[model samples]
Target: MNVTEVISPTVKCRVHLHVHLDGAVRPSTVWELSRQKKLLLPGNGSLKDLEEALQIRSPRDLAHYLQKFRWITPAIAGDLAAIERIAYEFVEDEARRAVLYTEVRFSPHLLVGPGGQVTARQVTEAVMRGMARGERQFGVTARLLLCCIRGMTENYDDTLDMCTEFRGQVVGIDISGDEASALDVDGSVNAGLLRAEVRTFQEAARRGIHRTVHSGEAGPASMVKLAIDEMKAERIGHGYHVLEDEELYRRCVSTGVHFECCPSSSFLTGAVPLTETRHPMQRFCQDGASFSANVDDPAITRTGLEDEYALLRRMGFNEANIATMNFNAAKACFLPEEEKQDLLQKLRQAYGVPGCD
Candidate 1:
């Protein structure tokens, strides 16, 4: 049986909260773009070669996993047309997997390649146009989120500014990148950079921009606490390590901070071990914490939203549990109050879950 046969029997509508726009570029698209731009590809430069190269079959550190971007990113980055095409394609891909709503994220500055003529605003505009067209064509309600890479202190303000400028289309702001590199050997946090990141999130909060931080994926539990307490993150990306601290985990459960869990990506990135008896999300589910399963990087993990649900099933989460997680995702989405309510109602009708609304 395939992924759809396994996942479609139980989980119906889905709300995906954590996925990177750049990381989801279609391998075929990457192949075509690389050929068009005369860019080099691994092996024979065929589509199969590109596909084989993008996937991370061997588990490695976070930094090693990120290096995969160097292959596909150059194809989409600095090219406004490529960015727009991929954005439109992203919606269609998600819609096929029964994702009714999704919030895709990327850093605009990164899209503006080295010495490229395109401005950050233009990059955002292209993505918005593509996604807008996609929404009409594919029937998936899509939103945007700007990302600030950790250690790139210079781009934080631009990310927040874009979130404020594109409030309705761009739903929120996020921070993602190497967590270990941000700390010293003694575990001393990089105070200056941390303060700058905090200031950016504080401004985002004051401007009413929704905030989510990539924390505690490969870092310690303290990063999750800092993301919640100092950065005012409304949701956490990955966040498996939050379970390391019992007090913090209990507090998170009480407060209902959403966790965007990516099972395949977490394993491939070495954030979680293959031989573990229990997964952190199992604890989150048992403790009544709010969390959702997602595909962090389809390009790398070679999985989809349905694949994530299947993984959750294998991890011992039942159909009801998966439905509740989808409901939790709908609740935690960054859409406006009225739109969010509409989404919840749609989910209620789709899942036919009593008292879910």
Candidate 2:
């Protein structure tokens, strides 16, 4: 069969595992929310203003690029209704992109009103309410990962307490932020914070909570090693530098540490080479390193789960490779073994594989 035929036949089976809910809010929706809330705009009071605020150009570092979210927050802040709507919309968009399952991460601590009155527990409840609504509306299954910002280690206790409050709703805890800012080799301000963060991760593991760390996104292989060895991360989010360490790469491959690869975000942030052919995702797959392509920020990157899959196809990934990638995601999911098996079987059946039932 031709490439087109193979891809078309297998598209239904593919699942995108990595997604960020807060980062996936539609820009137009944000603008509408801002207008409804009578929020002031820094620029001209129009959708163009919102777009300009979210627009990220090349050569801008990750920290600077992330700063754009401050402008968009006003659009979604203090509105549980808007949060529910955006959450539903995000899941709907994922379903449209043929995603069967997703694990979305968001920092609940950062979501607050102008008075800073909203507690972390309230934030978690609102997000869970949104996700519950989305699951009911869309067939796509989703689990939330409550993330703790790297620099905000002081809030670790509160974040963990919030996670416990929404225990059933949250599947994991992630330590995510500007990797370059957090993982300094020299004894910097965040060094002690990083050590404490590892202890928090260990505590989470002891409490039977899944843990993943955003490591090596902008740093070296040593950072990735630290996440695996010290933090005991079940998965490494955007470990782009892991390829530099041969031994570490082998350990990851043999130990089955999933790498949540966000192609558009990596390209935009200059972590991975921008060219489709030169993207490290292909090499990582070829080397038996398990990973799944994800839309890190649908709104900011102006791309979705389907766009990432399409990009991979254009980069010469075959249907079989794509199927394997989806399987890797399914296997690495935080869901129960029975649920994972059911999904894997469904995926195999969709691909017309014999004996799937």
Candidate 3:
């Protein structure tokens, strides 16, 4: 599982679709921002310290696990410069891991500090500016997914308005937060009805905006089904629980619902159990379900894209399988066709396929 051994120069395959930008910031960047802002961090000036604080070993509920992100939110505040620096560094880090294209997502709601300081419009512009900088500096084609955190005060109407205002700059909209809280949308139902949220998703779809949902992470398999059936999610984030329903698994495979699988986070959160051997990723792959590996929260999970791939490789995933996963991800991305075609060409070249050119 050594990153160096798997990332040899000969292996030039690229990771094209990862969706969490702020979540992927380096610990050093977090520390630097914390220090500059005079914010207190509970670490010994190491990535391990950050990981220990963020990673929940024995959590009573999902909210306790998600509360960890609140600790890092302050570091990301204070205006465009800080946001831009972290965005640039995030792309640079991805480039080092051989990622040629990426789609990073975040909710601008929390970026604004106390007293409604930073406007939502400003937050969008700052992030897009940083994305442009990353593209120019690193040759990594980037896109943004403006997300709405579930359980936030803003209901569907407010979220729709935000998405409409930043429509062009944002490629899509996603609902992300604690899956456990999402399950609480209704008192008796175990799975939340995304039907209400589907109004925005459908509207985005009509406008040709790609849609994806953070479903089945810690909830029942029915939640994943609702995301696909109700929300028309082209992709599912952390869809580990989908295997619970045979019908849903069949539909997911048959219909090509790309699952953005993150093993490290799933393992740490007790979603797939601790051991990598018993992880649902293997089962999902075996069942012919399309999926891509991702470092859901590189900063918190203390991992990188390379580490995720290396772990899968050790667990008996071949290079070709990894390449297929990458191809699936590229196809599932919310980028322009020309950009996606370019990435497909790169993938073919990396794998030494003759007809790819």
lDDT string, candidate 3, 223-262, tens digits: 7887788777898988888888889999899988999998
RMSD of 2: 4.3
For candidate 2, the 10 contiguous residues with the lowest summed lDDT are: 1-10
Question: Could you tell me every candidate's TM-score relative to the true structure?
Answer: 0.96, 0.90, 0.88
Write down the lDDT of every candidate, Cα atoms only: 0.89, 0.76, 0.74
Segments in model 3 whose C-alpha atoms lie over 4 Å from true places: 1-12, 43-64, 153-169, 184-195, 275-277
Best by lDDT: 1
What lDDT tens digits, residue by residue, belong to model 2 across residues 1-357? Answer: 443122232245556656677788878888888787787865887888778778776745677667778767777766677777777777776666677777888887677666765766776777778778877776778778888897788888777766666666687888888776664467232556477788888888888777888887777777788788988898888998888888998899899999989877887777876653477787788888889888888778877666777888988888777778888888887776797798888777767885642
Cα lDDT tens digits for candidate 1, 1-357: 554323233433899999999898889899999999999999998999888988888898888889989988889888999999999999878877788899999999888987866889999999999999999987889999999998899988888888888889999999999887667787656766588889999889999999999999999888899899999999999999998888998899999999999999989999998878899899899989999999989998999987898999998999999989999999999999999999998898888764654
Per-residue lDDT value at 13 in model 1: 89
Q: How many Å off is the CA of 267 in candidate 2?
A: 1.0
Full-model lDDT, candidate 2: 0.76
- The model with the greatest TM-score is 1
